[model samples]
Target: MQQGSVDAFGAPVSADTLKRYSGGAITVNSTQAITGTVSNDSASQVVTGNNAITGDAFSSASGLPSVIQNSGNNVLIQNGVIVNVEMKP
Candidate 1:
């Protein structure tokens, strides 16, 4: 993800946050399930489930577009931007 890109999860992340979590700048490497509410800030949020991290979140940072799978829906983030959100039927 690039700086200034807002993921489906709402607010424009701070530059520091972007630098910390951006595709190429990520430092940590691991896969972990995230449940409940995930938010970059008050304006941006995403509800996730046990399958939240199907892959390494940090490793996939440079993957451009990534999907955060959830029990309710799926969020698509491309180039650090929130491009599309798929709602469960």
Candidate 2:
């Protein structure tokens, strides 16, 4: 694994949460998972290696909407849970 950021509703993700997200699947485990956020002016971000998206409650910030995007990869909803997350205002 490599160093990167994980954002939650444009806010920086906690270090504890990053540890859980970067945990092992079976044999190999991620060495490091940094907790941080990208700048608001960022155009693109690339994520390599194993990734996990945990369930979290969503709240509107400044009365604006939140968006989550994934391209060219699989988005899994494991553990038989479906969260009704809206990506629009």
Candidate 3:
């Protein structure tokens, strides 16, 4: 909370991995039907899906830019997939 306030949803989440940490980096097994989204930037995103997670690698999203925005690289993830991404100038 930049406004000197504390909120659950408003708080920032620290995530390391994309697929294994979509849900705030949960230590889930390989066969637990995992899915996650990773944003490479503000205009592009990488959408990944692993519905089975049965010791198998799922699809990873790439270049999910809807509009040209952001001056530099901005990453955003939603639903186990990158919704938006932007390259650095």
Candidate 4:
């Protein structure tokens, strides 16, 4: 896998899951259950469930949340950012 590259499954090599930003700003505002990596700049991901979700290679912590929770995997980072990753549980 490569940075910014898509896999045979058409998913980003750096992302197992990515909900896009809708308002041109990063935010924790998604309402879905994530069992995979989730990374999106200028978007919001609001967790509406009670699961310890993992994150993808997230970048520019300047635009991300302070504390994130994952079930059972170590989060990975690249270029001073998170890029490739896995899910919890």
Candidate 5:
């Protein structure tokens, strides 16, 4: 897999599983793009990346929250879940 190449999941991932693997922090390398579906249900999720996201990005429910940081250009985030997005320069 490339630095920022998006990959698909075989099935839906549970919150606990995702948290265990990522330790609540998911980082994307420079100039990377996430073009796959991201479903996070952890208590607190943080996604730090710098590049374009041309796919669906989702967070947790009201009880659980998420913080996503990425660039401001060519990023398309559309989901019903509520999350705090910080757009960097």
Candidate 6:
């Protein structure tokens, strides 16, 4: 809904998922399955997922995690730095 909002998902994202990073960055270092659109656009996203998954909206040359386990995906990555993102499935 806004920037720098922290959320906790016990399941998958089945809606219009949009996240904004305003402070520093959002570190996604989980071992769960994120099935939705993931974006940040104002800061950086440190994706270090061993078993984390996405749903859709991901791009390869968009400075995103090319090795995402799932499909869901963004933000306007600056200088290869991810900021806000919008992910959905």
Per-residue lDDT of model 2, residues 23-70, tens digit only: 344453335444454444433465645445445534324544445444
If scored against the real structure, what TM-score would every candidate get?
A: 0.17, 0.18, 0.14, 0.13, 0.18, 0.13
CA error at residue 46 for candidate 1, angstroms: 22
> Candidate 3 — which residues are off by over 4 angstroms?
1-52, 59-82
The clash number for model 5 is: 0
Off by over 4 Å in 5: 1-62, 82-89
Which stretches of candidate 1 lie above 4 Å from their native place? 1-49, 60-63, 73-89
For 5-33, candidate 5 gives per-residue lDDT tens digits of 45763455556666566534455444434
Comparing 2 and 4 by TM-score, which wins? 2
lDDT of 6 at 35: 50
Candidate 1: pairs in clash: 10-44, 23-61
Candidate 6 ranges with C-alpha deviation above 4 Å: 1-21, 33-89
Worst 10 residues of 6 by lDDT: 71-80
| Candidate 3 lDDT by residue in tens digits, 1-89 | 46644776564433433435444434544433345556543545745443333333324535552322233334343233323332221
Q: Report RMSD for candidate 3.
A: 21.0
Candidate 4 or 6, higher TM-score? 4
In candidate 2 the C-alpha lDDT for residue 4 amounts to: 55
